[model samples]
Target: MSGAFMGPPWQMDWVDTARAARDSLPRRVRDLIDAVRAELVTVEDPYFRGVDNLPDLPEGCRISPLLSTVPSGLHVCHFDHGRGWIHYTFLRRTADPQIVVEEVFWQ
Candidate 1:
């Protein structure tokens, strides 16, 4: 994988699935969730703290930056289940830095 200093914060857009979750969540919680989601999509190498009992995702599952690290040019799109559950999937890259490839979400 390529290496570089963590750049500015980026906003990961709410994928259709995530948007549905945001819409169903409590207002206060939704705001925080949306903010975090946006941050993950826009930046490269965003900071993430670890979460307890996090499930083992599939080979190409998307995860939160708060729970995982995203490398430059790679990104995970969010999908909300409207039950306080969120899921993500790896998206194909468009332009350079358009996706989050590496993650420090456990750090």
Candidate 2:
């Protein structure tokens, strides 16, 4: 069996808010979410690969670990919407077999 479960991160309200505002969000923002969601379906090694940790992040996306904002393995990524970048956090646990999307910063 696959040891991977993709769902909402820690702060679901934030993610929910994003979904609620999807229509108003920029194309790149929507694309970022769509791409992330798609890649998560078949979670494997290099967990964040193709989603955040990729080769030459598509012009608008930038994923980096938020040293102090989260724990050791958590990360914060940015997806640009032409003018600015939307930040969000996620968790990838080695033993849990679960990927949690913590929160998103639209502003």
What C-alpha lDDT values do all the predictions have?
0.41, 0.49
* Candidate 2: tens digits of C-alpha lDDT, residues 1-107: 36655443322224565455654677766777666544443434323454454644455665556665544465555655434343344444443434445554455
Point out where model 2 deviates above 4 Å.
1-15, 21-24, 40-57, 68-71, 81-96
Report the Cα lDDT for candidate 2: 0.49
In model 1, which runs have C-alpha deviations exceeding 4 angstroms?
1-17, 45-83, 96-107
Instruction: Please give the distance, in angstroms, between residue 28's alpha carbon in candidate 1 and its true position after superposition.
Output: 0.6
lDDT per residue for candidate 1 within 47-90, as digits (tens), equals 33146533333222344433334342233334333223343433
User: When superposed on Cα atoms, how far off is each prediction in RMSD?
Assistant: 10.4, 6.0
Best by lDDT: 2
